[model samples]
Target chain A: MPRLSADQRHCVRLTLNGRAVEGEAEPRMLLTDFLRHVIGATGTHVGCEHGVCGACTIEIDGALARACLTLAVQADGTSVRTVEGLAPEPGRLSVLQAAFRRHHALQCGFCTPGILMSLDHYLRSHPLPTETDVREFLGGHLCRCTGYVPIIAAALDAAERLRNGETDA
Target chain B: MKPARFDYVRADSLAEVHDVLAAECGEAAVIAGGQSLVPLLSMRMARPKVVLDIMRIPELAGISLDGDTIRVGAAVRQAELLAWSQLKARQPLLALTLPWVGHAQTRARGTVCGSVALADPSAEIPLTLLALRGEVELSTKAGRRRVAAEDFFQGLMSTARADDELIEAIRFPCGRPGEGHAFREFARRHGDFAIVACAAVADGKGVRLAVGGVADRPVARTFAGLGGSMLGQALDAFAHELEAREDLHATAAYRRELVRQLGRQVIEEARRCRA
Candidate 1:
């Protein structure tokens, strides 16, 4: 096996949910692998490995991107917020996560983490996207178990809950 | 699957990139956002001996507007293009077609030049660039050359770009006072490659329609100064002129119909934009 080497392995140091995490990786290592294997943050799931599945979605500099499709070096010096980081206050799922649970948005729960993280970031800027917006926004994700009726409902429910000043936690 | 073992070089400058490409010759590959190239690498579909990482090159990432053209750097990510407020206001056609490129996540890493250089017939940038009359700036050890979008794409995943040349930037004429454009496509599912896509631009010069995904490369038809009856016939003639290739996505006949349907729809939408 030919050992691959980088002239300089870029050292990425960024805040992973208020905590500084640093690592040195080749420019080719996928951010998904860096998080799941290297950092042991398995909450960020990897589904299609390709960008087709949003299961590996994470927040980079407050914008959503598929972890599987992005190289770890690309996130250098940029803050990364994963599904684990979304609930940083701890002891509970975020409001969006709670709405998903209350609305029975997931089954088997394989894609839940990614959905939560993506929607969490999306809703932060959008705050209120219509039902059609939810459908179109969620088009990036694929769910085989529950179809998408419940998931869409969960997003709608969360949008309403967040809008109505019902509950932050 | 892990990509095959290969040497990696994170090029810090264009001079370094040129030297690396010259050194590795045919065995080198440049990566911008890795949205498209990374997948091919991981699948082992592209086994280049040297992967030239260009993401760190500060010279290659920005979106700017000159007097009348929008210049997008080679490394400018798709998200930047979509989010650009100037483009949104000046060119809604670009904004409309931007979403169809890929998912938000993929677009974050996908570069405008990468999409054009890859020149996937089904890719949105090439087709959109064709309709917008875009130009590509390519660089090599020899010098820099600009190629019009029509001349840039030769065939499926084929371009006039040289093996050792790097695409520097893509430029398209900005908004015209009375001109309007529209883009539409049909795919099996959202985020999937289009079965057929149409991008139409109309101005005082007349109507120009560009079609992609239904053919080996994007095909354009122009009806110089056509209107009313002449416009209708021109569209039919244009539809007849696009000789599409049949593939698993759709039969040749089916794709042809999509081209016609989408062409008509996009032309109508452009007319509305004009109004």
Candidate 2:
């Protein structure tokens, strides 16, 4: 079989953060690139192109997935939520984001977007999570700073606030 | 790094998959979860001419149980299996091993059949399947057939599947009454590939042991006389025979020790669960 030229591109259409979005991508264009470049949602950071680092984590059809490992074409017709989608509106932090800030959950801030997105999706189902549960959930992500203490605390605190029906500003 | 350009085709049916595989032959790579293949593609480790996306095939999705066997479709993601309460009750070994496959995010997209087909020596899913003596169904343009997990895995990143064959599903025998199962792996980080791992399934009469990350392929053994107390000594003796190789992460000797210790712990845990 002959190798395909790198110039080939496919039309990709997907729902981005509750909005219908369309983009053209090479078959090899990663979902992370499509989210950051074509869709212009730069909040989803890409740390490791490999799946090991969860900095490229996002939600596809409401399930958490690694955007780095998913092709943009694979996400055609799917709903995706990146870190940019976590906030209720632009310029205002969501409850999880506020909790992270209050608890000083970030230092380098490179891993924060993925961690926040992961916790944002996780806390919805696990509103009464324990420290172990938070740790287990955060295990997918790798953070170089903050030693994960603040992050775990932030996640637990956010879970509490969300449980109490706190509104995002 | 971004992957080199390739053509993408989504197969909507089993026939479409077979036809695509037949036409593309060795040039096409199937993309299910894209958990492993996508990484390889980005690293330029794999350069296929075309990538066949099998996620849209309705026939290749869903989980069903028949009397004593549970069938998990190729498109059924690991997260789906983890969330499947009935599967947890029926195949406790899978339930025990699913979380260790990767993280919640990877599992949310990774499929059981994809893991089995990849046949990664360090992956938990293949080791669990080997421990359970599961069967993988392969389909072609002609027909479909089943291969035992033991025979299906040939070597590192190799399997018995032909170029034209697509993995249809995998069938695992339902956990029997009094069957207790435990899975444990030692990795530097939670989601890192294991340095050594073990899965144990035991009843009062016999025990099945499968070890991964210590050799070219995951290995399984059955011992009729083994019990929780005897597992440590038995595994210690068995570890000496493993073809463990030294890698940057660990020495061969260290991996053997891991197999010995983790094997015993899993067996003991299974025994406790049974009791």
Candidate 3:
């Protein structure tokens, strides 16, 4: 067997936020680091490098996963969606984002991007989710600020708007 | 933290995995979901020379029903199994325990066989496998063999599987009629590992109880014609048999108490459902 140097980088090509992107990273580089550094999508926050914190959440091949725990090389040929893709246009908030603002869902805003991305995918499938459903879904995410009250309110409000066929606020 | 530098080999088939493992013998690690392995790698706990990526192996992915057994492939993600309606209908205990495995994000990438392969004492998958009397299929270049769940799990982070072999699938027997099953665990948070967990299945004939997180490996006890009141006493006696040890999260005595309490609750719940 042949051995590769620790600094040797591999080429990774994938679709990010609907556009085809290519970058170079070591086999050991985490997907979170690759996205923020190589792809310049810093919106995805990295909390615990382990799988515990939901701060590094992203959609890989239409499934939610922890970017921190996933290797960049393993994501080759996959489609990824980060928090940067949530809004329709620059400087404009999506309906869910606007609801977060209206409901004052975030305080420090570190966990906001991951939460928004998670709920963006979640609300699409669960348009008429109940309070318990919303709470249970929120269990995966951790919000140190605002006591999660406003976050739940914002998620519920966004679900209502999305159900009413409102994509943009 | 980033993982240590290692060669990455993407195995498109089982043969390729075996070839790589044979060549790199004792130096290569097979990665399916990378949920558990990646964490261990990042922490420098596992520093293999080569990582054989089995996620792309088409043969190692899928969920199928063969007769009375539900076959779950090694690459079948935890969330995928949770979404399979047939699995939920066939094995209600597994369905109840899957949600408690981890958060939605982790489950999206964590594999069922990977969890069983890791054999975490507190993991829901292993405990449920024990409770359901499942069987794990392990394959090497020589051949494939099936091991019962009870004999498969050795101890904390240990299994009967050889390092050169890969887990193919796990077969779970379908739930029988008139059987009532319940799974209950006490965890600090919704997704955290349980301090002590109980999985119980009761029928008119008898009851089977499996407990995890309070022992080195999941332990089971079968009772025939045991009444509800006697079930509690049996669990109390069984609690003393566990070699529960103190960890940062809990003490041995606390875990024993948990087993006794949760054991009775799950047994009663299963009995009520049976009735």
Q: Pick the candidate with the highest DockQ.
A: 3
lDDT (0 to 1) per candidate: 0.82, 0.88, 0.88
Model 3 residue B134 distance off true place after TM-score fit, in angstroms:
0.8
What DockQ class does candidate 3 belong to? medium
Question: Deviation in angstroms for B177 in model 1?
Answer: 1.7
Report the alpha-carbon TM-score of model 1 versus the true structure.
0.93
Question: Which docking category, incorrect, acceptable, medium or high, applies to candidate 1?
Answer: acceptable
RMSD of each: 2.8, 2.2, 1.7
- Backbone clashes in model 3, listed as residue pairs: none
lDDT of the structure predicted as candidate 1: 0.82
**Per-residue lDDT of candidate 3, residues B1-275 (tens digit):** 87888888787888888777777777898888888998999999999888878888889889999899999998899999999978768988888899998888789899999999889899889998999899999998989999999999999889999877889999988988899999899988788889998999899978788999988888888778677678677877899989997899999999999988998888878888877
Model 2 clashing residue pairs (backbone):
none
Each candidate's interface RMSD, rounded to one decimal? 5.1, 4.1, 2.9
Those runs of model 1 whose alpha carbons end farther than 4 Å from true positions after fitting are A1-14, A23-27, A166-169, B225-233
**Per-residue CA lDDT of candidate 2, range A1-169, in tens?**
2222347776789998889999888878899999888978899999988988799889999999999999988898899888877888878999999999999999989998888888988888888999998998899888998999999999889888888999785
By DockQ rank, best first, the candidates go 3, 2, 1
**Which candidate gets the maximum TM-score versus the true structure?**
3
Q: Write the per-residue lDDT of candidate 2 for residues B115-159, one digit (tens) a residue.
A: 998889999989988999989999999998999999999898999
- State the lDDT of candidate 1 residue by residue for A78-133, as single tens digits: 88888887663678777788888888899988888788877877777787788888
TM-scores of the candidates in the order shown:
0.93, 0.95, 0.97
lDDT of 1 at B35: 79
